[model samples]
Target: MRLTAEQIASFHEDGFLVLQDWFTPDEVDLLRTETYHEFGNDQPGRILEKNGAVRTVFAAHKSNDVFSRLTRLQKMAEPAAQLLGDEVYVHQFKINAKLGLDGDQWEWHQDYLYWLKEDAMPTPNVLSAVVFLNTVDDFNGPLLLIPGSQKMGTIDLDVEKKYQQLDVAESWKPTLTADLKYKISKRTLIRALENSRIVAAKGTPGFVVFFHGNTLHASAGNLSPVDRLSVFISYNTVANALQPIANPRPTFISERDFTPIAALPDDALLAPRNGHSSPQREQLASLAG
Candidate 1:
């Protein structure tokens, strides 16, 4: 799972690295099955697209074994650690299901922007590892990444008034606040980066992409008949965890844990689910009984 020096260099230069077939077809089948299982449940942290399709199911690691292990996958975790030069932890995990036509556009933004402003992250030592769970093509709203955008570092955005996601007290402070909510992409910066190439990555299931935290990226609304399913595991260096900040998003959006992740074996994700139940599975069985 170690990236070659050249590959690492490429990631630093271009702000992203795409690995084709990082997961086998079999592995993707299992994970995709679990993804759909999550989509079936209606719960908090499962956010909806503006058109009402599920945008993301956050924190699946807490409730699913397959996803839990994925957060610590060596292939994924090692890259983050190597780039950040420190041990890392999961900052956030999400299953993004962009259903056809109903899928909404994700405004252009950088991951570290949210981490720095909302979580008080001190450095851009965080990165996102995305596993495409279904076929992704240009028409299906593939992620658009601005090449070398991370080199410019964090951008100061003109943030709008924080929209309340909950009905609770506006003045009362929570761990997460409205002011730190995600802002729309700044148009001036977009115009500035217009010269940079925008890479629209299209790949089949199991392809993985690792991107810098400050990479400017976004996706168009899914207008085709196909769904674009993907999973994102954000890794933050332990040394660069977070300082105390104002009201933050819920735990699902920005996890509070700072424990360093211990990478599981390369074969850890290959275990068959049918032969033996995972700890979470056992719990589920007991609950059903």
Candidate 2:
């Protein structure tokens, strides 16, 4: 579960590292099933696209058994701790879905922007553990990331003008939508593109990509007939937890707990159902019952 020195160096250079088949197919099937179960709930955390398709479901780890175990899996937690060089806690957990033909485009932006502005996060000592729940290809919307873009640090933007209509109290919602409030301007993107190339994250259901928090990323609308679903678990260094904002976002969006996450056993997710083998087995049995 630990990352190699070469993989760590590559992540530092490119701001991302992809591990194909990081999870087994059986584990992926379990994750996909749990994702759909959470998606059917009528909760404020379930964001929808303009076309009425499910967009993103936030904080499922709090309510779903499978996702809760996923956050603590050794394979998922160890690398994040190694990369950040500190004990980490889950800052945000969500399932981002691109439904076939109905999914919308996400504009170019860094994931850290929302944390910087809304949560008052001090530094970018964070990373996202993205697990592919479905097969991703060119036809289906795949995440696009610029190589080494995280070294640019925080890109400046005029927030007042971009979100002039909404007050500061109400601006956090728009920033999470398709039309993001903190979008990277075309001129800035063009300049960055001059030095960096776009990488399409294409892989199968078990693929996992761990990207730096400040990495510039986005995705196109799904054009194919298949849906693309991915889990994004934002892991932040426990030392650099939020500093408190006046109008903080909901718990689902910005987790309030600063407790460092303890990694469960490697087989926590797919442990045998014979019982007494995994700490997660009791929860899974409860859900199944």
Candidate 3:
């Protein structure tokens, strides 16, 4: 599950890395089933688009047993600790749901901007480990990343001016929507493209992508009749945990606990569904009971 020296170097240079089929098909099926259970529920973390389709579900790890175990997967947490070179904790965990035909576009932006402004994060030493729950293709709204954009440092964005017309009381909610409040302007995006090119992250259900917190990325709306569901777990170095800020975002979006993650065994996900028997054996026993 550990990354090689060459792979680490590539991540440092490109600000992102892709690991194909990181999860088995059976494990993905289990995760996919758990993810769908979060939607259309009463949880305050569930966010919806203007079209009434689900956009994101925050803190699934906190509510579901399967996702709670997912947070500590060795394949994800180990590499994150290696990349950050420090003990890492969960900063935020959510699943982005871009439903078929009803999905909306996400504007280009750096994730660290929100963390810096909202949570008072001191540095850009955080990264996101994402797991694709469905096949992501050109027609299904795959993520678009700008190579080497993380090295640009934080981009100066005028977030306050764009949402000046809206009420401050509700301004925080808009930032999580399809049209991001802290969006990178076209002028700045053009300047970025001059130095780096955009690449589409297309893969199957088990695909995983790790990107730096400062990486500039976005995605178009889903045009085909397929859903694009991906799980995002943002890990921040313990040394770079957020400083206190007034009017902090909801706990679901920004985790309050700063405990370092202790990864489970590599085969944790593929373990038997029951305590000490195969899934079929457990099912038969239940019938006998």
Q: Estimate each model's TM-score.
A: 0.86, 0.93, 0.92
Tens digits of per-residue lDDT for model 2 on 171-274? 67797789887879888788778888999999889999999999999999999989898999999999999997787988899998999887777677876543
Over 40-138, each residue of candidate 3 has an lDDT whose tens digit, in order, gives 676888889997899999998887767877878779898999999998888999999899998899999999999998789999999999999899999
Candidates in descending lDDT order: 2, 3, 1
Instruction: Look at candidate 2 and tell me the lDDT of residue 225.
Output: 88
Q: Largest lDDT belongs to which candidate?
A: 2
Candidate 2 deviant stretches above 4 angstroms? 160-162, 167-169, 272-289
- How many clashes show up per model? 5, 0, 0
In Å, residue 182's CA in model 1 sits off its true spot by 4.7
Q: How many backbone overlaps does candidate 3 show? A: 0
Clashing pairs in 2: none
lDDT minimum window of 10 residues, candidate 1 = 171-180
Q: Return the TM-score for candidate 2, rounded to 2 decimals.
A: 0.93
Q: All candidates' lDDT scores?
A: 0.79, 0.88, 0.87
- Tell how far residue 184 is off in model 3, in angstroms: 0.8
